[model samples]
Target: MSDHLVKVSDLQIGFKNEEGELIPAVRGLSFTLGREKLGIVGESGSGKSLTGRALLGVLPPNAVVSASHLSFENTDLLTAPSAELRKLRGLKMGMILQDPKYSLNPIMKVGNQIIEAIQVSNKISKAKAKKAVFDILEAVKIRDVKRVYKQYPHEVSGGMAQRIMIAMMLVRKPDLLIADEPTSALDVTVQESVLDILDNLVDERNMGLIFISHDLNLVSRFCDRVLVMYSGQVVEELVASKLHDAKHPYTRGLINCMPTLNGSLEPLPVLKRDPSWLGAAQIGSGK
Candidate 1:
């Protein structure tokens, strides 16, 4: 078996533009994941989420996807049959999207949603599924499980709704978890709590995580390794602890923009764009 949980080489994702031209959103991106937190950080249009979605074969129908190698736990995601990909999605791999408000069903009760999740891949009765749902709700650190379960997505606060989303994805105990800006919508305290819960669960379950975010500081402190993306390609990669010493121009620019408590109260540095950085060789030889 491969030591890595996920491996991608020369992956490219593009969409059709006006006049039928192919507009590349992600190009020549390559990375490998193991049972640890790996952060993908970039600006709004850097294709961070696209990379995560491609791993699950969940890109939009209009997208054109190609990769020299795209494997998850030895299964080739690039050519996997639709039925096989569906089977792998929730059972072996799970994704937590950015906002719970849009991701969750506004009309469905949270409890029933979770119960459905537990029953989708496993052969379990409603009674057993309810028991499992409650257990998972507790695991995600929901204090008022019963009350929250009975409520609709619109009834709960953003943080609480996010916790329910996490519970839904994790109840299946997938081998790989891709969390795309999971805590971006919550308050500071709530964000920290969610990250703690997620970190603990990943360690306990020995699951590989691809945490996608725009927060460099959070990724530095929370993830074991970090991949810096710029203009749809990985520009640099370094250990999270060594983020301050990043060498790539794009990585350094991102670090310079983050505000520090003791630093000067000056305006944040503006990131300088360079056409040369677009197709440059990524650090760690990912090119």
Candidate 2:
């Protein structure tokens, strides 16, 4: 066991292409996490989602995964049993998917879903689970828990539904919360509210957070550390507050492309990636 709650080393994911050749999604990726926010920022095709799925042990069947070391606390998640991973996902490690509409069951009562998630993880009584769910809703700044609990998924607003998802995940008080584009589906204001809820939850719970998104600007503001990926490889790693001080060409391009205070877009900077930075040679560790 170490102070790090999650440690991924030399992790790799590949799948057979049409030509029957293996295509790597995430290659030789590595990192460490604890009680802090870690942001994974890259474009759509940069394998960011696959990286999060890998940690959850929920990769698609076509994918092949191998890692030198993938440990959570003292347990090696890469080889842990399905039952063990289930327990972790339930109580100790929770993940927030990109969309609550897809992740949550449409037919089930929203309240029941949250209660079921918490009850299964904690194996608590009905009364206890109900109380935990209500408290979690309040934590996320969702008012009128009684009404929210009675409503179905389709019955609630998108913002409230997202809050329910957050409440469901947080009820267990997980040590690590992996959010994969948690706000991508919401409107601008709802998105901010969701991010605010996440910020408050992470701070109050003292839990580790891994926020995966394409918006470098958002990640820079939300996290303490940033891992900048380009075409499935980490091009640079920097403290979030110092992202503007990044030295890597790819990282710099990302920063320059962000809309500025002046809001001038006469000629936005385009990323000029060095071909050498793409090959396996430079896919080396950011550590």
C-alpha RMSD for every candidate: 1.6, 2.2
Tens-digit per-residue lDDT, 1-287, candidate 1: 88888999889999998799999999888888988899999999999999999998889999999989999987998777889989999699999999898999999999999988888889898888888989988987789898988999999998889889988998998889999999898888878878887798778999999999999989999999999999888988889989889998888888898788898888889889999998688555322
Candidate 2 least-lDDT 10 residues: 278-287
- Cand. 2 Cα-lDDT: 0.83
**Runs of candidate 1 exceeding 4 Å displacement:** 284-287
Model 2 lDDT tens row, 66-131: 999998888899888999998787778888887888888899998899988877766788998888
What TM-score does each of the candidates earn?
Answer: 0.95, 0.91
TM-score of 1: 0.95
Which parts of model 2 are misplaced by more than 4 Å?
187-193, 280-287
Model 2 CA lDDT for position 272: 81
Candidate with the greatest lDDT versus the true structure: 1
Indicate the worst ten consecutive residues by lDDT in candidate 1: 278-287
